[model samples]
Target: MRFFALVAASVMLLAVAAAAAEYNVVDYGARPGGRADDSAEAFLAAWAAACNDSSSPVMRVPAGTFLVSQAYFKGPCRSAAGVVLAVDGVVVAPSAVDSSAWIMFHYAHGLKIRGGTLDGNGHAYWACKSKTTPGRRCPHGTTTLDISQSRGVSVRRLTLVNSKNAHMAIFDCTDVTLRGVKMLAPRDSPNTDGVHVQLSTDVRILSATIRTGDDCVSLGPGTSDVVIRNIKCGPGHGISIGSLGGEAGEAPVRNVTVEAAELTGTQNGLRIKTWGKPHPGLVESVTFAGVTMRGVQNPIVFDQSYCPGRGNVNCPGKSSGVKISDVKFTDIQGTSATPVAVRFDCSSTNPCTGIMLNNVNLTYNGKQAKSFCKNAHVRLLPRVAPRRATAYRPALPCQLESRPEIRLVGLRLPVLCLPVLRLPVLCSCYACPSRASPSARDRAGDPTAGPAPPSRSPHLLVYTHMLVIYFQDILGCGKFKKLGLQNEEALQKCFGDIISVGNDHWSPHMVHGAAAASPSNAPNVDGNDTQDIDIDLTQDKATCEEGDTNEVEQISPVNANGKRPPRPAPPKAKKQKSGTALTIQEAVTSMATSATSYASTKQGKYSIDEVMEHVIACGATYETNEHFIASELFVKKEQREMFMTFRNNEVRFSWLTRKYMAKYGN
Candidate 1:
């Protein structure tokens, strides 16, 4: 019995020794700076022994250059903590890659890999140009590191360079954290994306510096809850949300945030692209904030009609139906190399909505930034893309600057609750002259009833109009000139140019006779102030009526007495419920939807004065001359009355704006 007990004790000691083993690759016959296949076999042996150990085993590779062929470390380890691979050496791939990944780990959990230099030796493969031709169909050179079907994985402080394809590909992973990693490749290298994530969740990549030809970080299908912060990307495609929906059975991507990134000399700063074909999944709740760009081609973009293949050039596929919404861009300041700093070419079939641009200031060639928007509903928040037209800033929700307690509601059109006022108010209004109430002008008396006063500055009004005209051309309004105008055409063009112009059709200025029609005689025109015109919603739809001649022209010509005609009586106001009366801003709240909802509705066809009326009624103030130039709404109350003094009152945007007025008006 004593002999049997002694034998059992010996066996227990041996098991404990195996559990606590630390297998160094050098001791396992891995020769540093040796042949590829041999070194790989040695690494495999070390990993196999370490993975079987009962305790948390560690495999170490000391400093040296080790040539390793296509290798994989698989896990379902006996140890609770799995394995820790500490590599201080330089790992080199052979001149020709033999497999899809130079170093791969599969089905691993509780795995940690730290401190290593992965040299892909990609120059040799680039010379041979594998996968460069049609006949070479196979995936040529392998990605530097590939981790598949892994969880609880962490890779820290690794330097990877010259990858044949992507530097790292993480697939089907969760709870993955990569920190302080650096990746580099030639700026022109093809397909060498820095870190690619697909079908992954709960992934965090922080403090990464990537300089590559492709996207610094590319999120593929089924990636969600991913955060990428404090990244520096240059000489590459900055960060991309997809090339999604290429296939029929792809998944959705959501809840991705990219913050504090600096992108310099890159093709794109922040982009989301999908195939032009119909994609069923959605891409939503993606936010890109606090990004700085220098010399970037397209700082912010969304391209749903992406078709890059040669065959697709002529066909360009169909409109992509990937439901993309609730995307916000905040504090993205930069200088763009191209004039088109922002291009939102969304799919017509699934028009993008709930898009917000907040405090995004981008410039091109020392000029204010330019944007081309199509088929998308976007809210230009306060201080958005401040360029040549600074007026866009004041049009945003007033609460953003003054009232902190007020919260904004609605994504396409921002509505906010004012602390001083209880009801919600729309933030975006041109705050132009048309919004001035007819009663307000009537109380001030007529400017044309007497000779022009010495204090009244018609010259300032003319200069302001000229400035507004100049800005219209700068803001993609070339089509306005092509519209043929006759008498009072110049004034008609000025008053309606900001709004009421169709995409191609132009509105002619309303003039009684040919006297005030010419652009040169603009200063002598009867209506120089925008508020002089009362916006009458009850008028006939057409600008001209059959020979009534009494139909008030937009700018009525001066009579032989040098006096202007009286404006028609305005509609009566509805009585409010017994209590506090609603302010004019609260009454005209719906104008926010009509004026700012440029995505679905074409508000440009509404008269500038009409849109301005709603904006002004909404409590937005045209406090500066620059504001007047941008909105075509003079700030001075007297000036506004002067501009509208000689015209008929027609509310062009009333079809939509009046609905809100009826609901909220006092």
Candidate 2:
């Protein structure tokens, strides 16, 4: 029995030794000289040797910044099926090289490059490219990290700085996982994108901090099943779907999801780009959910305008012809630059269809964003509302200051909220002259009315009108030219231009036959503001409507009045309610939904006091008290949990909802 015990103890020691994986740990400290001064190719060579030797163990480099012009990670890097090539030391490389990249991993699988820093020291490369002329190949356009044709590879917690082209590239690879990675390039740096993925599949990028001059993550054709979550992006061309197949792009990109990402100060939050040179295949099934943005330009943009400034002919499929379909954008809340937060540009003929947008909240600068589309069918759950118009910052350094121009056509209108007024209204009246424009001789006094101080020559009643693009002058009439309200002909002309008059049969803006007959509500022969005009709901159903427009016209011509009413501070209701018990205001709060519940909260009684009080009072705690006991409440397990869940979103997303509240359809 004693002999058996000794043998068992020996077996235990051997098992422990086998479980602990380690490298051979060979030392390759080079003496500072011609071949070794700036090169650590020898150390890499040693590491490779150790990895290949069945007997040699894991190889590691000591603390040092090893300079390498171009390092090729070729061969079967035997990282045992699931092991990693963990680097703790810094690897320095020339920012640009003639042929290869600083660190290139080719045909390797199941690899992980983490826990290290890579520097592309490119001072010489930058200088060499600057003093050259046009048509010359620049030298500073090399990649920092390059991986191609590998599967199940991951790069996490890695910092890549000052790269020449795209900092990191995952090419023709599958299952590329990038997490906690930081990619940086100065704001003015040229062609320096954070990470560019090409011809890859099942790529997952999460919790990455990126600031770059170009696209943060350019999905260059041949990428699908890509999932990006929890990304912080600034000063870059926010996450993109394509620069797709230039010469030979990959197959169609499908099944993409981006969630819980913040894109502050980005160019485009969610974008779908097509290749200029036409290729086959399509991009479909893309979704952007729970994304937050701040001051980003064109938060949702589908840019088919591939006109290059350098005199390239506009080509649909000839240059690059690709169509995108089956896209969904849900729960996107934030502020954008352009009024049209959600803009879609599709083919004039075979335009995109079936776009589903739900719970999208967007504000522009401080105003309501314009939601618009062309040649596409978009279904927004709640009507797109506008808060106000605000200022926007331009990208690509504008030579002239200008506001973006917006055009709307062929839109499937969403439902709008309308307020109900009390019928028993007290009547108030204002006196006005009969003539819109009095003769020059009549301006002399109302001789018959007798010494009435010339009756003030007919007060003109210059009130501002949002539709028909009308502006107001103090003389009780509009500034006709600026407001586009000069005359009946002008009003007709403006109507014709704003809405496509050519498609009069299909167009919603055409005036009814009654406008020419009743003429009372319509503008007079001379372009003048008509009083007591009723908004033709049928005519204005697809657009914004003014309270007094008798005929169909552009809804409200929004203008930014000074000193906007301060948004009501979030109610300090310490009540902890979950998802199930959301306030009606919170549920149907979209501007497009017509905010009827605004006046629900009342004095002496709660707005929802009677309706919700009994349920909440009996089931759960409505008021929040730090010392409140959870066990005291006898509500159902599911109901209590649901209330808590909803309440949490309201508080956390308070700022976000406020930003996007006004920009529903805009």
Candidate 3:
């Protein structure tokens, strides 16, 4: 019994010793030198032994500079406890390498890489490319460290420098964490991105300091649930989501959070760029918060029309189709190197929607910065400092400007300038002296005729004539004549080449006789009385006669002298009762059906108020309602006014409604 116990104790001790095995590269004939010997074989041998060990194995590189050439550490190791690659020395890549990656871990799982300095030695490659002619291409060189098709990977406390391309790339991996990783490259080093993550999930990059020419951290397509925090980036293109949409059927990138990042003197801080081509991919639910930018050229940017080739030789003229929505930029305060600090040059086809800017204070040269938005629906939360320029040019006759003093039901409203409709109604009573009769001219001199009709301003008349000619081309000559405008030749001469007359169906002589003989104008032409013209601009000339005259008399009261009394102020709209609003799903479903029915019957034409009510009924949430309207409905050129109206009213919707509409309505 005593002899058996001694043998068992010896076996247990041996097993314990095997469990903590270590494989050293030096033991595998690795020499420390710049040119004496290549250490790639020795490092591979060490990794092979460590990986096959059933124990918790570690492959170690001691305190020396080892030169390697395109080493690949392939995995599916026998070690159940995983393998650790710990280096206390420097691993240097040869100046002239052919492979795309200097050191790559392929299909590696449960891998931990800690405490290494990787020197890419990329100066030669960069210099070679710089000397190459524009038409010619040079060797693209390699990424420093790449981990592909791996899982449960942790890279910590590593310093990577001077990479020919990206310093570190995480591709097609899952459950990866990079902590305390420092990457350094010259500011002028082309395409030296610090960390590039693509087709990966659950990636956490924390406490990283990156200085490079390209993006410090870039998240490509199919990347989701990424958390990037505590990053210090400078002299680089600050963290970017893309230059995506280069191909069709790309996967959507969603649920990315980047917070507590500081960017200094970078080309851009927090940018999402997509190519100007047709792509079905989208970027959604991205949050950039608590970011501090110092002298960044563009603090916040969504460049959907990204054409980066020299001379734009390969530029795609078509608008981008990638949908970017529900992106929030919060608590971003900094100084901008350029005056336009915040730029949203989104795609005209798939305009960036549901963009919220909250508590963003960006300054340009110690003064207020400006924001430029094109085809982007931006919602400014309280305390957004950068003032938006009139960059979003809507295809409408007049741009709506918000006038807080103009209230409807106690809500501040944007005042739409309907000068074409209002000017004719207000100035109709000012009869021409040549047209008016002698009695009407005498009545204009009477003090008791209230005040003589105010003389028309020459400038106003010219402006009105221009508007008439412009709308005449748009609404057709029939509608133009129905506006009761005279002196068609004068207006055509005044506008001359500026107005393109597309409608040749109606002759000016056809309307001139009617204008001269109309009973409504006879009294005004004779100048017998300064009576208000009761023309209903909203109705057609035929429909205007059908309108109740008694209702018009009640609305516009006339005195005994045949002069209209002072117009009564418009009645305030009653405040709506706070009834139980429908849930987002209910609102969207109801609105989808209603919009489809309305579109089928009316050719999708809607009044501004009708569109506003539709958006309101949809509950105004970007993800559910606003996105639906912007992307699915109101996207036609004829519906553009409705789109602009809803945007001016600050009504929002959702992008998810596309599918909902597809399922529930046309």
Candidate 4:
């Protein structure tokens, strides 16, 4: 038994030693010291041996210069544990290699590449494409390192210089980390991006230094949840989010953050660009914070109509359809190489919105910089050093304008145009009435002639009653009922008279008769009860007769005997305790509840259009241009929070208005 046990122990120890194996390139016939002989085969042989190990394996390249050409490492290795490529030497790519990438790793899992220098020998390739070098067809230069279709990958302390194209590319990958990496190339190198990330997520780049001609870091379509911190970039186009929308059906880019970056003498500090073509993609929830720019040109930009070549030759003139929103630039202090420090050249068809700037200070040649904007909705918080252009204004709340006149219950009151509904509303509190004295025709032997308009003083209650009748009869009370505004008694108490007319017509004689019958039920205005006043119908009748000819049909509430008819009985009021004014939170809650209830009737979902309808029904008032209602809502903290929370829990309704969805939707 002792002899058998000793033999089993020896076998187990040998198996363990075989599992943790190391394969050296020199042992596999790799010639070092920058040999003319191709070393790609030796490196591949070493990788194949190491990858076949069932446990942790390391493939080492010893301390010497080696020459390789177009090496490809493909894997789903036998090892369940990780595979490591440890290089203590320099790898040089031969000149004139006709491949897309100098080195590529595809379908590799749990791969770690540590400590190496890769030289791409791109000087001849660059010179061949120069204008001075005539009649020379340039071969498509290769990227230095390309990793695709892999996960759990990390590259540390790697130095890549003079790549023909992009230095390093992370494509269709996840959970990737590139730290302590350095990429260097000439400032005039064509199309040599330092790092490019495309169709990837959960990518982190920390403590990287890049100097190149193209973008230091470029994020392509379908890239999200990326965090880039402590980057030192110069002599290149700075970080960019696109050149997207080049094709239809492209995915959106979202949730990206570039923080603690120092950009010196770059072409642009931060930029987002899209082609002038049709695409349904969108960008949102991105932040660029704590960035310091030194003499950067165009420190901030959003160019939706991007055309890459010189003079924008052969570029399409159509507007871009990619929507961009919810982007913030905070604590960005910079010096601009040009006078215009910030520019927003957004698409006219799909305007950029919900952009916020906080504590951004940019100077142009030691003076306050200038800004330019077109088709963008920007919110400038306090401490913005250079104010926006005169043509642009900070996004403000929506303002209901009084441009049309509405005839309600024989009173011609100015109507407010509700932006959400695009319809005229007869509410009295939203707009000041035309207080001009009654016309000569109205004053000619009219007993109802008075200095105060129907929207003010003793007649305000009557005007409000007219509004309730208009809403109930003309606008369909069932719709308003769903919004929690169909409570006749509550609306009356909140505004004026509590009158419910079942039909589409109201008469001044009915109001006078009701006041005459029940004096205590009348509203009190200016220290006097409305019941004590003698209401007249002559001016009301004349005003209605002389109103616009295109008004909606109205039925008179007068009998054939020229006498006022009795008012119809109002709806039975619900028995509820009276409450004090609501706090902001309570108001928002009430609005959300009403919106949810209304949405349930539609399809178990709600949108900004539906919400805005409810807001109008609840008598919410704002102040701004009519085109900015959705933007204003997103700018207000309480409303945005409520909407975001509501959207997260419920199914989103996609049939919202295009304008609202483009600016505020996810």
lDDT of 2 by residue, 1-666 (tens): 999999999998776654344442234543222223555566566556645644324445445566666766554456555335566666676545653246776555666666777777655555554465766555535668877667888888999887665678776678889999998877655556677775578999999999976678777555789899898888787888765433232467788898898898876788876535555546788888999989987788775544332334435443345667888888888897765566666554445666767666677666555444555555434322232111111111101111122222322222111110100000011122223434212422233322112322111321221122121111223222233223446334322322211100000000000001121332254544655566687878655435435665344444488455555565685877777666654766565354444432212122223223323333333442210222322123322322222222222122111112111100
Candidate number with greatest TM-score: 1
Q: Give the winner by TM-score: 2 or 3.
A: 3
Candidate 3, residues 219-281: lDDT per residue as tens digits? 877789999999999989898998678555456899999999999999889999887787767
The local lDDT score (0 to 100) that residue 604 gets in candidate 4 is: 25
**Per model, how many backbone clashes are there?**
17, 49, 13, 1
- CA lDDT of each prediction against the hidden true structure: 0.63, 0.52, 0.66, 0.65
Quote model 1's TM-score. 0.58
Q: 390, model 1: CA deviation in Å?
A: 7.9
| Model 3 local distance difference test score | 0.66
Model 4 regions lying over 4 Å from their true place: 1-20, 132-134, 309-315, 384-666
Q: How do the residues 1-666 of candidate 1 rate in per-residue lDDT, one tens digit apiece?
A: 999999999999878775457788988888886554358888989999988987878888889988887677876677878789888998888867754467877667888888989988888666555345654433354678887667899989999999876788787678999999999999877667899887789999999999997789988777899999999999898899887765445668999999999999988889898778875768999999999999998888787877653456522456886878999998888798876677777886887888887777788788655565556656654442223232222111121111112122221211121110111112221111111122212212432232212221223322344224221211112332333222235433322312211111001111011011122422334566454766775465444444456766587778989898878876787876543345555556767766677632432233446445634443333762223332532333322432232212211111112212111110
TM-score of each: 0.58, 0.54, 0.57, 0.57
Name the candidate, 1 or 4, with the larger lDDT value: 4
Candidate 2 all-Cα RMSD: 35.4
* Candidate 4 structure quality by residue, lDDT tens digits, 570-590: 689776544543466588899
> Which pairs of residues clash in candidate 4, taking residues 3 or more apart in a chain or in different chains?
399-624
In model 4, the Cα lDDT at residue 525 comes to 54
Q: Count clashing residue pairs in model 4.
A: 1
